[model samples]
Target: MNVWREDLLTRLSAAHSATEVFSVIEREGKALGFDHLAYGVRFRYPLSNPRIVLLNNYPEQWQTLYAERGYVKIDPIVMRGMVSQIPIVWSEHYSRASNTFWEEARQFGIAHGWSQSATDCRGLQSLVSFVRGAEYLGSAELTANGARLSFLAHAGHEYMCHQLARDHHAQDSGELTTREIEVLRWTAEGKTAGEISILMGISDRTVNFHAANAMAKLNCANKTATAVKAAILGLLD
Candidate 1:
């Protein structure tokens, strides 16, 4: 196993807090020789802003451009990943003509080695992306390392979930029914109540009910805050 992978596993095993786990993930990205690592949580509703965590190597200029340009709205990789339960290699998605991020990414010397894996934890969608430089992550090289990257990405998500759970283990909020947890998880992912209702094969009103109950238990001001607090408490995972 790669030393970075081993280190990641060790840190995750020992992590008692979300901060500690995220710190380890940052270090793991650095150790893997990537330009940066980003983990973001996208909410279902447009009104709810997404939450982001940057690891290392995202330039301020690039960050500004990415956000100011509304790139996320048109980012095909993100859109696809949100609906997928499995991992996706960035290189494969880059081939699509509709992938808006590709042009901008190439200009940034971003490697083709990028890959993302997503998990739905209590309605919040968490995605972790590993990005490298163009020279470092050529097509051929990416093909060779794809499996390993997938493993690492999945491990990273699992680590986050474990840490989140540990953080909330001692808290005594009102017990949320399984359906409520499911609704909150999707709500965190930026899903509309109607969309969630369709996905769960339930009524929109039922979806709203679960969300309302979850928010009350979490004592959050709104859906976005509730999602964030749920993540912090490890309730989503």
Candidate 2:
């Protein structure tokens, strides 16, 4: 194992906040010869709107343009990285890449890039990218950096998800009581409050009471979201 990589992983895993994690990653990316670093995590639930969390150090203009133009929908690295199990050296010259998007990105000083994605235990997918304005990556360069980049992608994803999970847990406001957890767990099984009441030998009003309390503690809008949030946070386990 590389000493630098061991130190990097230690620092990342020890990070106390998302900002600290990104700081370590940005500095490491620069040390690795890239001028910019980016990472994104796509949440696992809510199939209609799987939330995306993105962090990047790209130029401000590029960030604005990318968001306004919705370039994520056409980004080749993100597209392939989400499904690929290896580090991918992506370029603007790829056949299927959006020429307009790449042209705009280049004008803003984002050219050469490499990316890889990793999936967490909960099926969440996260990707890390290293980008620079110059120095195209040749086959030799790719070979030299492939393993390290893969390590960075996976290690970065792990700690990023760690910080994210911490944030989620923090937002829970308070711990769920035993009855509240049991109610939510049953609700997660697609059981209606009435059914859960019958199953638990409790009255319908008492079931609703527990579910409502769980929702409040979890900071969720309603019983369904409360149940799902509890399950995601492993509170139901």
Candidate 3:
């Protein structure tokens, strides 16, 4: 492996949690001439609503503002990455149609950024972005470093997905029983407790019992969320 690849693997091997992984990414981003980094993972399934996580070392005020204003819902970079795997370099024109999203980001010192995305076999999509203060990212720079930047995105994404897979396996082993999975799968298939009970040859009360147990174990808000979470984690597969 080259130096960047070797360094990334070494750091990821030492990372035990998402926070640690983000820290490693932050260091790597800085070394690659960035001051801030943002990483997000989106899990597939439940085509209507998927699970997502965002990690960043952005200013606290900006983080709060972004959430309160729901900037993510309209972020051009995020919207583009959802359908395209191409790397994006932020530009004024990119946000021209959006409602001052880029301007607001600049106010928070998040100007001049690049973003790239990658997807894994498990249907996990990862988008990694790096931002710096002043220097413009011209074409020549992109020609020279775009591949490395793309590699960085992939590296961080794959490492996080690996961690997620491990956590899911551990969670499945401890939290979800076979019966619970059966109930959840049926629930995901749009079956009510009554219908599931009839199909499974169990009492309605017993069906609800398993569903409730699964919900509690999965720490879900409702049966729907529990079913979706299980499917996204590949526990249903």
- For model 2, the local distance difference test gives 0.83
Q: Candidate 2 or 3, higher TM-score?
A: 2
TM-score of each: 0.57, 0.90, 0.76
Select the stronger candidate by lDDT from 1 and 3.
3
TM-score of 3: 0.76
Question: What's the lDDT for all of these models?
Answer: 0.67, 0.83, 0.83
TM-score winner among the candidates? 2
Give the clashing residue pairs of candidate 3, or none: none
Q: Rank the candidates by lDDT, best first.
A: 3, 2, 1
Candidate 3 residue-wise lDDT at 191: 97
* CA-only RMSD, every prediction: 9.3, 2.1, 3.9
Model 3 lDDT on a 0 to 1 scale: 0.83
On lDDT, the stronger of 1 and 2 is 2
Per-residue lDDT tens digits for candidate 2, residues 1-237, read 589888998899789987789899888788779999998888755546886788888899999988898887888887887677677777643656777888888887788888888997777788888999899988897888777778788888888887876775576759889999899888888999889999999999999999888878877789989888778767877
Q: Among all windows of ten consecutive residues in candidate 1, which has the lowest summed lDDT? A: 42-51
